[model samples]
Structures are given as C-alpha cells and as structure tokens.
Target: MYGKAAICLTFVILFLVSCSIYIGTVDLRSYFFPLLQSPPVLRSLCATGRPLRVYMYDLPRKFHVGMLDRRSSEEAAPVTMENLPPWPSSSGIKRQHSVEYWLMASLLYDGQDEDEREAVRVSDPEKADAFFVPFFSSLSFNTHGHNMTDPETEIDRQLQVELLEFLQQSKDYQRSGGRDHVIPMTHPNAFRFLREQLNASILIVVDFGRYPKTMSSLRKDVVAPYVHVVDSFTDDDPLDPYESRATLLFFRGNTVRKDEGKIRVKLAKILAGSDDVHYEKSVATPKNIKMSTEGMRSSKFCLHPAGDTPSSCRLFDAIVSHCVPVIVSDKIELPYEDEIDYTEFSIFFSMKEALEPGYLVNHLRQFPKSRWVQMWKLLKNISRHYEFQYPPKKEDAVNMLWRQIKHKLPGVQLAVHRSRRLKVPDWWRRKR
Candidate 1:
C-alpha cells in the first residue's frame, strides 16, 4: 500500500507539472483567432513569459516562388538555391510535413471569390472526400467604413451585411447523421475573421444571422449532409517548421503600381541586389517557377514592401514561403497579434522611414548581422510553431463561428483533477 501510494503521488506530481506547461500544448482557440480578435493586445507575453505554444498549419516549405509571369513551380525546372530562400538553420527538422491526425480539416478562404486556389489543390470538380467551404470573398473597402466615398469600402460593407443576414436567417443546421447542428451567429461579433474560421468548422452555420429579416434564407437549407454540429478541434498542435531564409524585394521606381507586375519588379530588384541574400527573381510568371531548397536554407528574411497595397500578398507569401517577413505597412490590421512572435518577428518601416531610401539602407547596413540573425531565428521558430495571429482568411471567418457556438452551447466536461495541496507544516516532521 505504501509503494502504491508513492507511485500515485509521483504520477500526480507529473500530471500537475504537465498541466502547468503551456509550451507545446496547442491552443485550438488561437488556431481560429487572428491578432485583432481581442483588444489591449497580447504583446508582452511573447517577449517576457513562457512562449505561447501553437499548432502551425503552415504550407509545405518547397512551393517554388518566382515572378508572376513565371509564377508557381512548373515541375520541370531544376530546383536550386537561386530560386529559394536559405534552409532553416539546423535545429534539424524537415519543414515539409503534414500533421495528419491532429488536424480536424483544413479550410481556405480566398476572399476574392477566386476558386482557383481550391481548384489547384483539389482534384474532383463535383463530389468530395475532404472538401473546404470557401467564402466567396471579402466585402468591398467602402463597405468596411474605410472612407465614405471609397466604392471598395461600400462593396465590402455590403458583403458583410449580406453574409450576416445569411447567418441569421437560419434556424438550425442541415441533417448530417441526424443532428441539429445549426447555431445562431446572433451577435455582432460573430462575423469577425477568427470566428469565421470556427464557423466553417462547425456543423450548423446560420447563414443569415446578421440580417434580421433575411434570416430565412440560411444556405444549409440546400447544402449538406448539413454541417450543423462539428466536433471541436483537438489541440493537436504540431512542432515548429523552422525557417532560415530571407527574400528581399527592393523597389526603385516611384511609378510602381500595386499590381503584380510592379510587385514582381520590386522583388526582382531585391533578389538581384541580394548576394549574401541568395535569391533570384524575374518579371514573368509560370516560367519563373523555381525552388532551390538551398537558397531558402541559407537566407533568413523576406524584404517586403507594397508596390501599392496598404497590405500585399508578399506578407502572406512570407508565411507561406516560410521566410520571416519584414513588413513595411504601419496601418496594417494583422489578424492575430497575441499568438505570434511579431515582436520584431516582422519588421515594420513606417511610411516616413521607408521613403528615405539612403537612411533606410544605411540603418539596415548598420544593423549588426548577429542582431539581425537573432531576430530572424526567433521569428522563424515562432512562425514554425505558432499559427500567425491573422484575421480569418475568408472561410477562416467560418472558423470563428465554431468558437461562438461552443461558447453559446458549451460542451461537456473533460478530465478534471482537483488540486492537491502541498503541505509544509512547521509542526510536522520534515518530509524531505
């Protein structure tokens, strides 16, 4: 009996220790959240405390990056370091891996109504084995309250209204294995980006919850085995996908537009100017398809600047390409801040700083290689481990919805253990 008691005590201690450890425990809550979800942001935690653990559902590391005219790999070119960033420095883990069992399912939201991304990833046109529900696109800029006269904002708001209405109109979800899966989006916060990703994962998604009168037209009325009730995501967080390569895009012209051509030109300049940087670029797509694992292996930062966007795909490409992004957008509304290591994980040059080319160049030139390297490694580890706290990308907003449902209809309890008091009474004989 004494031996058994000792063993149980040891086990209890181990359990408690594990519970207190947040390092590797994947927080499913963050997976669906982007940085903007909560206010009075989680900035200092990443810098001061035990790091925030995350399940990074990042893309495979070898997707070749090239100019738009020569965009995406062609499957024919010889992959070389000239085309890719430096390999992630040697913690010795391969970046190309799929955390198969832990993932509930992957979903993509283009926010442009462009199904091409989906079309490229999946094969079947009609039927499906594992399929993703794509949100057609984001609202126009004017609609988002950016500027009253901004037509784009107006369009953005209209889409939000329409999407919200669809959610409210729904009473319940479609019949899957005979269950009432639908839940109410009934609140204003329901449509936030992170919430969107959750919504996509949930079974019953009220399509018109935002539109009070239009709540009658929930889309699940037509589509299913209706996704009304979904199993909550398991916190099957994967290890980090360490990245150590950098890609710099330097723009030389003031006439550069926000379009792909301009972006590519800037990218080429950065790549061309780069030697210790190790990369290559071009003005073409489809043909520029190249992936040199070596180049990605040796480098560490992607010098990002918008030829013309308040934000651009270059940032996404950084996360996707597995390169630490050096951002230049100040007004950028990055989705999730708390879960990421953006504390200089990404570098931001305010508009004034970037405009002064000589000063910017000199500052970077003056930056100690050791300091830059340390910053790069720190961010690389975070990106590899933490799912960037980004706003829900299209369907990701659907993800945010599941969170709401889980909140509204809280689930059953899991294993609950009472805390054991560790007594050290002065009157007692010293156990030690």
Candidate 2:
C-alpha cells in the first residue's frame, strides 16, 4: 500500500508540471482541456511553444509529381537569378510565378534555420499538427484546365477524384474530416471539380471571389498574394519617388471583365482624356511587361481594379516599384493582415466612389506631398513580406504563410474536438 501511494504521488506531481507548462503559454484549461478526454487522440500537441509539425502527403505522380515534368517541358522557362526582381540580400534565387516552386522547395529542402526545424516533415500522420497536400494544383489547372470549354476534357477532375478517394481512406483525415489539411488553390480555377466537397480543408487560395462564405472566408482560409512578375526598383533607381513620378495615375490591363471587374471599363472611360491618368489596355507578354514597368515606375498611383478575381499581381508589382496602389475592389482580401495594416500603405476606394467621374483622381490629388511620400516609403518596406524566396526567409511570403497557419491552430483544435461529438450527415461520410 505504501509503494502504490508513493507511485500515485509521483504521477500527480508529473501531471501538475505538465498542466503548469501548458498554462504558461495558453490558458487552454477552459478552452481545449475540458473537450479532450485523453491527451487528444486526434491531435498530438507540440509540447508547448514549438512550431507546429506539418506532414506533407506523398501523393501519386499524376497528381503533383507529373506537374514538374509537364511544366518543365513547355509551359514557361524557369526564371534564373539574372531575371529575378531585386529582393533582400538574404534572398536567394526564386522563380517568377513561384508559389508552386517555393512551396515545394521548402518542403523538400531542410534549410539551416530554427523555424525550418520547427516545421519538420513527419512520415507519421498521427504526430502532425497539419497535413500539407502538396499538389501543384495551380500548375496542373493552368496547364490542363484553363480555357477548356469542355468539362469532360478537364484532367484535374480525375486527379481530384483520386485524391478524394485516397484522403477518405486515411484514418487521420477521417478523424478531423480534413479540417487540418492544407491544400494550395492559388489559381482562380484550381480544384475545378468538387471544391465544395473539400471545403472543410484549409485552402491556400489567392482570393475568396471563387469560393462562397460557407466554405471559405478570413476565418478558415488564407488569402495569399499572387507571385509578382515585374522587376523591382533597385536602390540606384531613385532617391525621391515624388520627384521621379510624372504621371498622377497609371493603369495598363484588360478593361472588360465579369462582376466587379466591369468597373474597369467604366473607370477607363471616366479617366480617359485626363492628362494625369494614363489608362491603356496591355497584354501579359514579356515585351508588354517592360512597357508596364516603365509606366509603373513613372506613375505616383498605380490603378488596381479587380480582374477575373478580386486580387491580382498588379498590386504586388506596384509595391515593388514603390508606387502607391489605388485599389478599387471592395471585397478583395490581402495576406498578413494580422501583422501589417493595408490602410497604412495602400489606398482603398469603394466601387461606388471609384466609378464617380473625377472623384477617384481628385481624392488622390488631395493628399499632401508628405503624406504621399510616407505612404510610398511604407509600400517599399512591406514589399518584402509579399515575396517568396528559396530556402525561405524570416518574414518572406513562405514564413508569413506558415505563421498564418499557426494562428489557425486554436480554431482548428476546437473544430476537431467539437466534431468528435457532433454527428455529421450521411452525405459527408462517403468515400467517393
């Protein structure tokens, strides 16, 4: 009896230490502890103040592996360091449309960094905080699904069907119902088939325009900035943006688009003949980008009206050029909102306000020289946060994305716990 009593006391002491450790960081006693019967059979905690462990799914060749082969053959050539935009000195080589590339690089290459050590890939799914489905969904869709009129010819649908089957069979996916899974859907048309089916999963999309509130929002999804294509202004370019910028407002892109994008056509008509605003239709070719770069650098405010989606790469380009972005989209979402405030750097105008004749330009002109200069300086400083670099940097787009995913852990934990008791419908229980 004395031996058993001593053992009980030891166990009590260890439990108290563990609870104290947990309380130091998060007061999860009222939040996560009560819901858990054991030490979370579904989620294995990271032992306090550690970067969350993420498991990258080893999918079949056709789904993600084959994508590298396909794009390497024809889509576009790899962007070398010579062509890369001016990034921070710490930044290494990076691709132009690098969302797919940087994600794969980070997952495959174990860099010499403490943060990278935190996100070590585990083969065991049971020990992971999140499951990363590294499907080059954007690359796959852009190659096979984009501009296809026939739904039957779409190859992404077949891949999605297979992916759904594979995920449903996994015990880990069954436990959380994909709430802990992270899938990149940066392209507007990515995951064309059964998007609603995978809505429970965390989607890394460029915007919420394609997804409804039931499946995606600021709550469950991440809004990633598009991979910028334009070259940035170097330190040798200009000392003063105001002195160098001759044009008041400049825009060069398609004028016609669906939904909120139609405002572009109206604004083009309104701003036409205004000497300060240079509005012209431009294509996304190599030569046109050179022309666009010149225009952006020479302009004070770069016009960023909505395209097919709520957000576009133009805003990022404007930032790299040290040009203040005059945004007109009301529903557009940006990345890293928790850390960086958009109002401090960029200007936002409602569709109603932008459509009004001369109101948009007049409002921009009303800002004093000091205010415009301050906003331009802020824009240049925040440009690094929007960039994706190889091996990942401290606060680059890749690191910020991981940080955002970390912020969702509490909410994901609650959802997983609630789901353990909540009865899901029969329709949501099917494998196919």
Q: What is the C-alpha lDDT of each candidate?
A: 0.34, 0.74
Q: Where is model 1 poorest over a 10-residue stretch in terms of lDDT?
A: 93-102
Clashes of 1: 103
In model 1, which runs have C-alpha deviations exceeding 4 angstroms? 1-134, 138-168, 172-256, 259-298, 319-322, 385-432
10 residues in a row with least lDDT, candidate 2: 39-48
Model 2 segments beyond 4 Å from truth? 1-49, 71-98, 116-118, 148-152, 423-432
Question: Estimated TM-score per prediction?
Answer: 0.35, 0.79
Write one digit per residue (lDDT tens) for candidate 2, span 212-279.
77778778887788877778776624677687899999998878888888888899889999998899
* TM-score of predicted structure 2: 0.79
- RMSD of every candidate to native, in Å, equals 19.7, 10.9
By lDDT, the best candidate is 2
Q: Output the lDDT of residue 429, model 1.
A: 57
